[model samples]
Target: MIGLDPWSPQAPDDPGLTALLEDARAAAGDPVAALALADRATERLPLPGTGRTAELWRGLAELAAVDLTVARTLEPHLDAVAILAQAADAGYAVPPASGTWGVYAAEGPGARLEARPGDEGRLVLSGRKPWCSLAEHVDSALVTAWVDDERRILVAVDLSHPGVELVDEPWVARGLPRVRSTGLRLTDVPGVPVGDPGWYLTRPGFAWGGLGVAACWLGGAMGLTRRMRTAATEREPDQIGLSLLGKADMALTAAAAVLTEASSAVDAGLVEGEHAWPRCVRVRSVVHDACETVLTAAAHALGPGPLTGEEEHAARVADLQLYLRQHKAERDAALVGQAVADGMPVAWA
Candidate 1:
């Protein structure tokens, strides 16, 4: 009910971003090229928050806007791994932006990275860490390891070093082959400690970074609206189609507004102050639901026709669907609701 234009005439844009998107798109056609280009563009991006770096990066992402969570996850200045480096430097006197980087923190029966002490008291990680996005390609990575049953350690590792082995052809996601994320086995991979422990999640940037992800989701939802509109317009005029288009339009319009306001907050250091967590939870959940609405409306409106018949449209939907799942889902929903009920400062007022 509280919304403005569906699309901002001047959200954020750059000349270089146009070239970067072009290169990125061309590179996306090849897995190897895509990996290299992501790093290249990341390095080329000015440091975050410098000259509207964050806003422009998110805007450029909307240009390609094919719902590619993989490339979006790996490439650009907003990358989690890259942001980790920035956080490390700002919080712990570490350099975050010398080269390409990744964050591999997932753990499980199949995705375990064990940490042990070395003779000099440095951290050494061994075992297999699954979900290492672009692990084989990135120059370095920020990894989380089990220090004990109840503790975890964050370490920075040079991926090219010995004892680090990328499992052969580990990724097979049909929607995001360009991301190249997969399981990797680390056998005594030496690493430098990032923080005392819990630094990764405790930092204010953690929540800010989570909001960055929501920006991507919102951008993708808006991008998908183009196809949704085309799908509705090409068909015989029907109430159902019109309704679906309206739902998709409103959902994306709401998402865009939230993202714009959230981005303004981030730029103003509001997210960096006391409101980080609740603000993050609220924006992520809201944008996540909006994206779902768009996806559903677009699907039901188009029926099985575009999903099965058209390759590009189908690929975008599949990619966005998979990418959207990265959000915490119902857990996040409950947590955000609780925050609001408890009166956290998630509202601008």
Candidate 2:
């Protein structure tokens, strides 16, 4: 496995980092190694500054011909946030604020950024984004906004523009805190358009993005399952033991299978257009159930240790439990019901 610690302060060229990246890239060419590398890299890096890190992991996962939508969603948002953080650390201006969907807005008053025609006959942006991720470190960013009465556009803009305002309130969360998901307010910051209007969320890429979040949750469940095994072994023979171990193992296996199947469906582009909402609802349902099962088993197995201890494992368990609240059982059920009402097929091949 690649040994570079992504959280290290050393430059990207550091020998360890280099080796890790090289190994990851090479493994991308293989099936088993690629999956291993993806799993390991996520475990190691967790929050990477460049989208490339997540992309690499995404690519590795893709090698299995698996659907990667859930993984993709989590990465781009985190990566975008990471870029803003890196930009700030490098002395670039960044906006202050928080929230995943609230990053786009005219939060403050300044030279408003807008896209205009460039010398190459391409759309150019002339606006600033407030509260952007890694805004301090990134001299520019890729932003999406309304261009006219009925058009929206995504563009790359320079953060250093006089019209930009970057508020620097850092984002705080129990998991993936390294993402620096700040907020941004835009002024007329110069930018270049990436694709046509509304393409960002409507494309195959966006579908995969949502799937990525499901994958992250799956990973967390996997982590909990591992912890459960360790805790089970540490249990006294008479204490809550083998039953818990078996339950956790079974839950993990089932969850992993569901995730793999859903990922495969997404990778094959079978989860789009008419099937989009149904597929999403189904995956969300599976993930919600998986999380519940694994977490329950872990809690039962670990007993009061997780609740009372200050150890890293305990903290991880707590975090996972807290996050599961966001994927409410009720909400998922509603989605499934809606999918059925709409007659969208939920089965994946």
Candidate 3:
């Protein structure tokens, strides 16, 4: 008979497991991570109380990572939307399965996807979407389409049904590739209505989603900083080593400060009403700059050899560089300009 001691200190704790636990705890505050965790945990743990606790923890974590204004603006719907979409993709039953929405910068002919309420009160989606993140994994999507007189309408469609095709070409982003962004084609698929036409701009979804992206980028940046520090400490002292060390410290400090400030602002409810758009844009700018700065520093410190090397740190640096492309700095600049034109003070100006 084998005896198991529940309180035995001699029980070995796996270092990898311990590290994973710490990572999960840290990620709990990030909306993306929290949402992902909630989705995964709920799937695995069906117990009602346990599932609720996991969901609560995930929500709390998201709140901790973002500002209250941003959260309030987007959290009401985006959280449920993303999670429900993921769950549906994973073959779970999700109510309100089909809807319509639109995409920007689409490829192929007839780039617009439209949805209209059907006789049975369902939505019929028609159009194409490029760069639909997690499209392949979702059961349905809310797509945007041009209505009468060129007005936009939000429509939802079921991906599992015919007329909905997900292109296998996945978005090759450095981080969060597991989310599996892909192109989607909908040729009159069944769908449902979400909100008023062209309401995506008026809703908090875009802003909140941007914040989630920022959090994920910040996480990757922090991970890179940690790897760089470790590598610097382990390497032989040289000009590259010294330069890398200094840059890592500076870049990490700056990025961390900006992220903290943005998170604090979100948590404090300073992002609502007329101030919402401008504040969100400003935070996006800050995150974009910080991501660039940190990635550059990491790459410079590691050098071309380690950067292209097969090591984990090298791979991470490469991934960070790739992920930075998603920031859309030009768009942020445009938003800032518009805000300034509208009499909002540009923070840096």
lDDT of each: 0.66, 0.50, 0.50
Candidate 2 — what's its lDDT? 0.50
**Candidates arranged by TM-score, highest first:** 1, 3, 2
Residues 284-344, model 2: lDDT tens digits: 5676687777778777777786667744455456555555554657877887777777887
For each candidate in turn, the TM-score is 0.83, 0.61, 0.66
For residues 122-225, what per-residue lDDT tens digits would candidate 3 score against the true structure? 66766677766555444445566666556675555556787878767735555433444567777878765545565545553345445555544555555565
Model 1 clashing residue pairs (backbone): none
RMSD values for the candidates in order, in angstroms, are: 3.7, 10.8, 10.2
TM-score leader: 1
Q: Which is superior by lDDT, 1 or 2?
A: 1
- The most accurate candidate by lDDT is 1
Total clashing pairs for each candidate: 0, 62, 22
Model 1 off-target regions past 4 Å?
1-13, 43-57, 67-70, 73-81, 88-96, 117-122, 167-174, 177-180, 232-236, 272-275, 341-343, 346-349
